[model samples]
Target: MTKEQIIFLHIPKTAGTTLREIVYAQYAVDRITPIYRDERFMDMETFSQLPPEKKDAADIFIGHFAYGFHQHLSGNRPYKYATMLRHPIARGLSLYNHLKNLQFAGSEISFSELLKNKGSQFRNNQSRYIAGWGTQKMLETAIQNIEKDFLFVGITERFNESLLLASHDLGWQLKPYKRRNVTSTMWATNYADQLRNDKESMQELQKLNTIDMQLYEYANKRFSQQIASHFPNAVEKLLHFENRLHQAA
Candidate 1:
């Protein structure tokens, strides 16, 4: 069978690192097209900028990207697009905590200060700011560019199921999913701190994450509707998919 040409766009704070690792492992076995992270391929000016040479390295593109990517997606490329989403609130919390940890590593800005200023500095300067600002801006960009591509959208909340479907589509052996990069003692408390120290910032987080919230809600609703429309017994299939995975582990 001809190998399916695929691209995995790794959006920030989504289970992207884990997915990228999986794809990298598959690519090494000659199971998929050659792919790597190149910055030149993605031409967006905001958020984090990737190196220009990163684009020339892959058959399947996957990384943290913004709008206008389709213009650069290789043509005649039979492509399947896959991405994972996280709850906007959860993502926002993750981002904030990540930045605060970095501050301990030499960043001078206090987490509370960053929260108070509304991410103006982070958004304007950093390569990948987690202030959770402008999520709609990112989503709208992806939506516009990926309209014609074969896209598979999944939520991190349902990661293993999504991986099973993706592996099946790509004709790969499915394995039980494992959590990657989890530290034994690391915990999440940054957002909780905000609730105590900066009520205003918490509110902004809600507002900034509005787009992500909508995107997730819409994607779930859309996926459910699509499954129900196309497969007469989709709920059963989904439940079975979950049950089998659970039982196997």
Candidate 2:
């Protein structure tokens, strides 16, 4: 068994729910250490105080926390970190729609207004989560951290490819599983479609997430390089993986 436990830093709306299910298949229920709710963050104080036995037994710790969670772990077990990134604008829109669905205090406001609102917490969220800061310049820090500390930084747009690469690299047996915590409603769909044509909204969205956009593009570049280095037969292997899923169906 792989001794390196995974500390998954799950950014919001980055296909993280689907990735969690895939990781779940590789470990027994007892091996997972759930840290926080969807909107809440991982509590480092509580995590560091986990009982020795429970801490020692954990093989994976998944949560919607910022990076540096590995430092909070209690045991001596070696660990690795992983995270996912998405197209910053798409992720930002998805997050907005989700909050709107929940009737967030300002749900009635326009998307542009939400971006302009200084209180909005979702802007440049992918970079913030990875770098553990909300500054515009932390984009380079996020990329440095990923390349230095993370086992892999997966991209949501290329989720299947990411999964297959991890499976091949780590000997993980990824059985077919359902996507969880999906966010598709008619209003959400309609708004997303209309938002594409609204140049002003789109421009504001891009401007607010400049750091996140750059971070995402860098991840895409690295993902392609990773595929070339680690799985040159990637296309054929991906097709075979899909064939198995169809056969199972």
Number of the top TM-score candidate: 2
Backbone clash pairs for candidate 2 read none
Give the lDDT of residue 65 in candidate 2: 84
Per-model TM values vs. the true structure: 0.65, 0.87
The per-residue C-alpha lDDT of model 1 at residue 86 equals 73
Estimate every model's Cα lDDT from 0 to 1: 0.53, 0.76
Candidate 2 per-residue lDDT over residues 117-219, each given as its tens digit: 5334566878888887554568888988887878878888887788876775555775766667666553544455556678988887788798888888889
Q: Candidate 1, residues 1-249: lDDT per residue as tens digits?
A: 114445555665566767767776566533333223455433343312434344333446565543234445434445555567677666666566656554444456655567665463323211122112354455555454344444566677767656645554554445444465432115544443554356676666666655556667766675565545655765576676678768876
Off by over 4 Å in 2: 38-45, 105-107, 116-120, 134-136, 185-189
